[model samples]
Target chain A: MEEIRAEFSRIYDTYNGKIYRFIYLKVESREVAEDLASEVFLDAWKAFQKGQNPEPKIKNVQAYLYQIARNAVSDHHTSKKFKTVSVEGHMDIQDTGDPVEEQAAISIEIERVRGVLKTLKDEYQDLIIWKYLDELTYPEIAQITGKTEDTLRVNMHRAMQALKGRLEPGVTPEPVLGT
Target chain B: MREKDIIAKFTILKQIEPRQEWVRLTKQRIMGVPIHERFGFIDIVSYPSFFRISNLSYLVRKPAFALAAFILLLAGGVALQVTNQKLQNGLSLAEEEYQDTLASLELAQAQLQELRVAVEDNDTEKVSLAVKSFEERNAQASKDFVKLVENSSKKALQAGMKLVQLQKEKSQLERVLGTTLGEEKNEELENATKTLIEQELSDLENRTLTEEQQQLFAEAKAAYDDADYATALEKVWMLSQ
Candidate 1:
């Protein structure tokens, strides 16, 4: 029991934020996303406990959490638990010590891209969020979504093109990271 | 828009995160199971496994059947124990019987050895009488018959040599037994008669002989000097008697 607790604690710390962000992207409601995210972890913990002794129930824990999160969101939507709302949420504050003008300019660019990202279909949004924002590889996405890597690759390309078409002209983005 | 720009835009979602206090509480809620729930007997009875004893509730519901089942189990154990003891007793009895048979075999072998000694002595006496009879009949028997008397005659001569060395007695008998009716046989016969005379004289020491026995001893000495071994043997036996 202690061993499971220690291990589950470590898993919860590592992926809790990312899982919340993934749900938040789909639900677009911080409150509903938090509830669903908590439910996903609780369900995963119960599964881990009830697993066969000396052998685990889950193989890829991160993918399983994402899979559970996906189901939670799907079930929430099926049940019609919350209404959709549009609002300009606050941006994450960072201490990069940039000029006020530069910081404001980057924040505005991030908001414009986010707005256009919301315009895309849920399918396209999932590929972009998991691939770019969540930064998961195609194989990891495939495990969570139960799709082949080839299909995800083709769909990712299509999703990118669709995002590009929806994004406005002359939106000149900030310098890409790691490039 | 460029592909890089699109990816860069979506990357902003990385900053969107749940509240720290809410994440902390949620982790507590997921991990905070009660002690009783961890080891719940209800779960064990409900679980689909061998440990589920709920199906056996009918056994407890009937007292007489339960008592009968317990009595059967106890009787089976006692029967098994009794069978084990009987097997042990049979093994010990078989071991005792084996020891008795071995002892009986040894006693039989000892009795057989005594019978062998008695038969060999009886054969010596018979061969002695047969040799005397053959000389009285002028040696008419075949050579094969002489060979047959050999083992008994040799032992009889050794018995008559009272204090002679056993090797001397054996060599003298072997020499006579190996010869036929020839000069060598006569010489061996004379030598054997002398040995017999010496044994009779040794016996006569510290004893006063009657006049007749003294005359027989003198005659025996004379016959032995003349190489008349048969007469010498006859008078020697009379003196010995």
Candidate 2:
């Protein structure tokens, strides 16, 4: 039991930030995201403790954590609709030695992208966030989303296209995938 | 913007991080360390070997004593199993109560929406039906609230507040329809709504709200004053959860 606790402590330290960011983006409330993230880890610990003989061992812990986070977010939305607050002012974007005007432009662009992301379907939003923001590889996303890599690739292409359509109304995105 | 530009912007979201306090607190909780340990009982139970006999020579010299120790350990194990079973049952019951409260709130909201639409259309018959459904669900919710309080779940107060808000809306609806409905019908609805609201408010007033709950309640009131019923209801439900 002590060994298990040590291992879990290590896992929590390693993945807590990524898990929090994943949930924070979806809920857009610091309090709710923190609460949900705590629940996710607590649930994971309980599951680990309850495991007995013949229970399947978790192979990919990061993907497993992401899968748990995905379900938690899904359950949250099913229970109640959340009004996504703008992340622009709430975010703590570090200064990269850029000029003031350049930083302001970046903030504006971030806000615009957030607004457009909110308009997309939840599945597309999840895919885009996972692929772009978290930078999860296709197989990792596939494991979390329970979709084939091929399916995810197609979904990603369509999601990007849809996002382009929303961000720039008159411009059509070129198809990145060949027939 | 191109997909690459979007990705670059998305990268900014990674800057959001969990507070250091939360990370430390969560780890402590997962490790079963109480925030405040008034006694050493938890430590003894959590690490039983520390309290157990470690002297091999002492145990080897007395077989009967060893047998007695083994029997005592077996009995302790059984007792622990029974205690665990009771704890599991209690948690399961609490979860069921939480789900019931959520379902009742949801039903109440749907009924309220229907009442709003009916009132807007000025359909007396539809209004009456909506009111009847609302009253039935509201009464069930009240009963559930009482059960939850009896069960001693902290959520009972929040659910009771929601019931109070629902009753307030019912009173407003009654007042709006009073001029058109018969005096007898208006009086009946008014009396029922008033009694329910009074009961819930009395229950709420008896229990002091925590500072956090007080803040939420104040925010909910502000939202209500602004006529944002949805946000008000959301805050109240959040308090309940």
Candidate 3:
């Protein structure tokens, strides 16, 4: 029992931030994201307890947490209770004590990027968030999404292309940003 | 914006964090207790709502409780088997009664047809014998049908009532034919019987019938061609809504 609690605490402390960020990006309300993020942990705890008794233990807890967060978000969307809150309000753009004009310009720029991201398909949105925003590697994304590494690379390339097209229409090709 | 700039901006979005209060409360709520102490048998007994039947691992570790649980489960299984056997027997008896009723109804229909032919031919002796046989078969079929309806489930009740109505119509037709024959084999009576058969056939066709009913419709048509109008009428009544 003490071993199980220790394992759970380690997993929760390590992945809670990433899971919260992943859910917060997909959902509109911070409150909903917080609730769903907490639910993901509770579900993982219950499943971990069950696995401790007569079931094969989960090998990849990080991937498992992402899977739970994905299902929670999918359920939220399927319920059709979606509400799109203002992205500018939730984003805590670092306050370096900049001028008011510079801060306003940065906020507008962030809002424009968020609007373009929202226009993309859900798969593309997920790929961009996991790869670019969260900085997850292709193999890690593959583990979370249950896809092969080659498939993830191809999908990520397509997602980046789509995002580029949405962000800058009629622009000439430039070198790809990241490996 | 450059691709690097766009990626940088998107990554910055991850800096947003949930409030500290929410994080603290959610962590406390999820991982406040140690694992074994969380859902113990004492906790389950104290808070019945938290007791999940799947959490009987501790009971399985004790040999006496495990053996008692196995015996209880086995006894419950045996009891279920016994109840199922009784239900199967009842269903078989009802099925047999339903078959007997169907056979008697068919025999009554045959006798009724013979009576109709006898009436058409002005043969009083054959008509008398046919009437007696038809009455006996019809009475038996009605009794068996009632038994089937009483013994069977509610789903069979509607079909059983329809069979009862068909029997009543057949008896009415028999009475009309008897009265018509007692007076004379008039053209009016023959035409009346023909019109009645046609009306009943149209009614049967309008209904949303099953495959068995479509076959019965074809059989009724054959009976009509053989001048067995009584059997055709019985088939049509049997197909009623």
Q: Which candidate leads the pack in DockQ? A: 2
CA error at residue A122 for candidate 3, angstroms:
1.8
Residue B212 in model 1: lDDT: 87
Rank by TM-score, highest first.
2, 1, 3
**TM-score of each model, in listed order:** 0.45, 0.46, 0.44
lDDT of 3: 0.65
lDDT for each residue of candidate 1 in A1-179, tens digit (9 for 90 to 100): 88889899999999998888877766655668778999999999989998837799899998999888888988987885465544335444232344334545665766667666656666666788888877889988898889899998988887776656456656543322110
Arrange candidates by DockQ, highest first: which order? Answer: 2, 1, 3
What candidate 2 gets wrong by more than 4 Å, as runs, is A52-56, A80-112, A165-179, B34-241
Steric clash pairs (candidate 2): none
- Local distance difference test scores for all models: 0.60, 0.66, 0.65
Tens-place lDDT per residue, model 1, B135-215, is 222222112122222212322232322212222332344364442111113222334446555665566655798998888
Instruction: Count the clashes in each prediction.
Output: 0, 0, 0
User: Which pairs of residues clash in candidate 3, taking residues 3 or more apart in a chain or in different chains?
Assistant: none
Please give, for residues A1-179, the per-residue lDDT of candidate 3 as tens digits. 76887888888888888888788777776668887999999999899988986654898888899899999999987875554534325443454344334555665665566666666666777778888877888888888888898887787776666656545533333323332
**TM-score of model 2 (CA atoms):** 0.46
Better of 1 and 2 by DockQ: 2
